[model samples]
Target chain A: MSRKIVRIAVPVLVLLFLYVPILILALYSFTDATQIGAIRSFTLKNYVTLFSTEELRSMIVGTILLALGAALLATILGTLGAIGSFYSRKRTSSAIATVNQIPVINADVVTGFSLCILLVVVFGVSKDSYIPLVVGHVTLCAPFVYLSVIPKLKQMDSSLYEAAMDLGATPAQALFRVVIPQILGGMVSGFSLAVTLSLDDYFIATYTKPATFDTISTYVVNATRGSQTDIKTALWALSTLIFVLVIVIVGVMNFNSGRAQKKEAEKA
Target chain B: MENNQNIIELKHISRTFEDGFRAVSDFNLEVKRGEFVTFLGPSGCGKTTTLRMIAGFDMPTEGEILLNGQDISKLPPNKRPINTVFQRYALFPHMNIFENIAFGLKLKKMPREEIKKKVKKVLELVDLEGFEKRSVSTLSGGQQQRVAIARALVNEPEILLLDEPLGALDLKMRKEMQIELKAMHDELGITFIYVTHDQEEALTMSDKIVVMSEGKIQQIGTPEDIYNEPQNAFVADFIGESNIFNGIMTGTMQARFAGGHFQCVDDVPEGTQITAVVRPEDIELTAPEQGQIRGKVISVIFKGIHYEITVQSGRYEVVIQSTKSAEVGSVVGMKVEPDGIHIMIAENNTNVFPVDMNRNHRLEFNGTELDTSLTQLIKGSRRNEEHELLDENGEVIDPEKIHIIASIEPQDIRMTDDVDDEQVLIEGTISNLIYKGDHYSYVINTDLGQDFIVDDEYLWNMDDRVGLILPLDKMRFQVKK
Candidate 1:
């Protein structure tokens, strides 16, 4: 019992050690209305100032649209790739799997730097365009989607596809009706991963992203660098909203998948 | 099912893989309407290949496949009036039982109401009606198989092809499904082309059995016909346990075997090699003096319903089964009626030429001039190896070129305690003896990996080196036309 308590204690101590400053920042965001050492009372001015600025709203909308679009695309592509490779012969599949892991293996700073050059030099596209932002985000986020989907696809039973084919379905029909539906659990996870990765990606987005494109991450980074104390509380408010929405989506998808699986089991 | 109504006919069908290995060749079969025909063979015997050809999954390299006299070789699987139930019942994991059964019907664009009714009726037929809305992932294996069957049946194809469909099921489940499938066959009256390696399954479920090996049909007949009247030694030995002996023709109706002349029923010409088939059930055991042939009981095994006794006479091991048990050490006499004798030409056709195999496995045909390859080798030798039996050396002889001879009865070869330089045959003991319900198989421990499979009524024990009997009837005409 003492050992169990000790095991729990070390990790908690480490977490507290790391999160103390974040906790302080969160508290300071509400009270940073006046200069330091005064230690003035809490106010919502910083939070209110964020809402009052039209640019903040535009940046949030842009960030949300870019993240959602890239994440959704990457999720579908990764899932299809994973499921496809799962059914294929080992050598061809291994080659494709190697390609899927390339994004993660490449250093993030290097990828951001290289993509910045490619977008501006090769495509000659403007740096601040939403296309560059979405492109950069998808490049950074797709590997996470791939990583999430591959495990689920690997765990799937191959006999199910054979069963479907033997029962009079064409190869194409089997892929859609049997293969895709069976691995949809993986699809939700892959989507979540891509979305989360896209929402958090700033290094790549900041480098090649359009001038007007300030995702939540870039906006916060810029706001902090510029010493704009007004938007600090609003950043917290925004993080909480994103966290809540992600939780709701995850819970709903999980519940939906569970129910569907139960129904399938009963029918089977 | 076999009353001259041909439903599917395979004419001169041959299948050779791209690697140039022939899996099946010149396979011909005519399936009567609604008949349950089984393709039974050991692994790599082209039985599954034959089934696949019928299902349109594979095309024959030569000749045509006709369905009801209409050529259907060019048709794809779905276009053909047939459906296959695979070894693993491929149930759709995503679809419920109702949707799975209805899938084919939906493809046909049948009315929604009609599809629903058909699906419901088929589900009821498979005893899974209430499971229409339940997902496949939740069902037990048997239930899933039924769903697969229902899925195929709902398509209402004229024929059903099952490739070892019960292979994956447990023994008990397999037995149950066999009965269920047989019942389903009767109820539906659709032609079933079932492929299986299990001889018992073939015998039980099939109206006709096609025994195949090495891409060729060994025999095609009813179960009774196959068991009672085997065409060759392979067929006889394959269908049931058999005690085989070789005897030289003493007269047109007589054979000289084991230093005894017995009255035989075959009409082989004088001087030709002959094979004798003795089924175990025909050999009656009796008291030592009263029996026609006397031997010592070497082994005894208890079957669920009968007792199997093995006896050794000189070098021969004869196995006999009876409801009554016999003491292992007792000496017994055995009796076989003249009518129990089966004679055939003692040779098995093989693709392997005699020259390529090891000398220890060599076979002796009466004459060697008939094989073109052998003739060519003999004509080409620089310093000719002696043809030992020839009076004068007209051509070269190579030990590698000699053919491997097959005797009619494995029991005809008598074992010897010592190898005399003049004696070409080797010595061995009864390493393993099996009493099949109908015959006994004895594996001689030649220790050369060339252990011989001999059949006889004499039951022998392990570690006994008995004289090998090369009965006169086991000799064969070396020439092939």
Candidate 2:
């Protein structure tokens, strides 16, 4: 096989494998039947109904709120951890890094089961409160933020800081005025990565989430469960919205990186 | 410049590392307010160590370093009123030229407008005007070196220490910077202490040259003094091309060598051996039998200005240089005056001390003193002499038991005896001829398969029949020890 054919074939194969269920769900929603591949007819009625439902509105609001809260919190913790660990000769930044990285690698069911035990059983977190879900989502996303920031932090020249200090800049001034500006692009990308991670998290949400709150991911899971339901239109709207969001966020961050690279090249 | 006085005084400075390496011995140096002194030597001679100790990077273990009359031995490098222009020009890569120059002034908290004015002036001083906005990496190597200099000089520190700043530059750039730095020195006069291994750089730029060797200073003087009157053979050989002749002191104004007797100038002890140095330019080539010295040409190299010739006479390989080229395989004579010979005691041989000895070298004949010119000693005595003729067990032969061959070349050799055919003859084959601007050197491979080099007045070609003679002055008594 030609190189181009193989390159296209692999991703297409994975896509075909992934989209089959979603395609079936869409076809059933348009058919006005929620039974898995039970009937095949096209209609927008399910999406219209979804728009009118009060739970859908609340779910969208809750998902946005959760993602923003988790992203903001993760960004702060991860940036601090990265800078502190990277700058110091002896610091515990790596310990926090390892702790967060464990969640990324652990089986989703294992992590969910463990967090459920910790928050609901050990900490006695009430099931109706949003605290356990928010805590779980933040833990899931912080590692992503830390990972994204690390490359940028390491790339920063340490001598610039020394030069600033030698030029009479106070330690704080040198950090903020010199170091922060140089690493700002990384921080932005890390925050964007955190938002993306928090938006897509569902496994942990399913196990430990409060009763009153629902993210879009968990809402989609529950919405597609019933029989004779218009699932296709609803999912298309959801996937398109999500796809656009990802593209926009990723595009802006990459655009920032391009400008920064250009500026660095000119300096060189 | 701080005060119109001594800017630095290093009192008995000595540095020892933790691993038991002594970098510099107990050395003392003083710098005036605006003097440009250069430390010159081969690598690892402790010149850079001395510079670092002054900059407060390396603390001396056993001395007081006073800057402006205050002891600064314990001060850290950053706190001292000095800066270094490193050999690599270690400018901050992240900063532009403007920031690099303004760094020290900014640390001093000078007002922004005044800092800008001063930085601009220094940039102009280094001929780096309009380079304020350029990143350090954008500039060429020479520009970076200049920026490093301006960065240090703009601070107006009491002293500036440069550790081989031009060592990385190419030849043309180096020469240009040397002239420019010397001009800058004349204009600023900021007590510049420069370190380098290039002797010509030291000779061209320094007001004073501190010649160092091993871990100690060999000599300190003006360029003329170091070149013309080196205190020892090491200094003479290190400073310029020299033909050194080792001999025993024959009392008040004379020393005997394999090549001849040298009219000595320095004071000598009662009984000691010394070595005299003759510069190639000071030696003269004459006829084979008529001149005061005799030798056969070994090889000749043509210099643009003169011929550099190596001649083998007696047991010594003497070098003569002149404007005229001579034919190879010919016996040549040489002449040397009293002023041309610089006598110094050899460093080895416990009997050869620095003091002048008796006027006549006395040889002991069965415990009785005999009147013999002490023209020679056992080998391995001069600093240039590396190894001895050893026995099978690798032990040095006892000085009294070995029959040593002798030096045969002198720039001025007069005929004292006829040429013995069976004995060693200066007559042989002409190997090469090199023409220098004012003279020529002839190389002749002898019939004994030994090569002889001679520098003479006449211009001669290859393969000439020549009778050979060895002057008594250039012949050494290599008697059994």
**Candidate 1: misplaced stretches above 4 Å?**
A1-5, A14-30, A33-39, A44-52, A110-170, A243-268, B1-5, B11-26, B56-64, B170-173, B231-238, B243-279, B289-293, B338-344, B348-481
Please write out the lDDT profile of model 2 over residues A95-131, one tens digit for every residue: 7667768877987667777888998899898988888
**Model 2 TM-score?**
0.60
Q: For residue B352, what is the lDDT in candidate 1?
A: 20
User: What does candidate 1 score on TM?
Assistant: 0.75
Backbone clashes (count) for model 1: 39
Q: Give the DockQ-based CAPRI class for model 1.
A: acceptable
In order, the candidates keep a fraction of the true contacts of: 0.44, 0.22
The first chain of model 1 has a TM-score of 0.82
Which 10-residue span in candidate 2 chain B carries the lowest summed lDDT? B350-359
- Candidate 1 structure quality by residue, lDDT tens digits, B42-101: 777788888878777778888799998999987766577688787777666567778888
If chain B of candidate 2 is superposed on the true chain B, what is its TM-score? 0.70
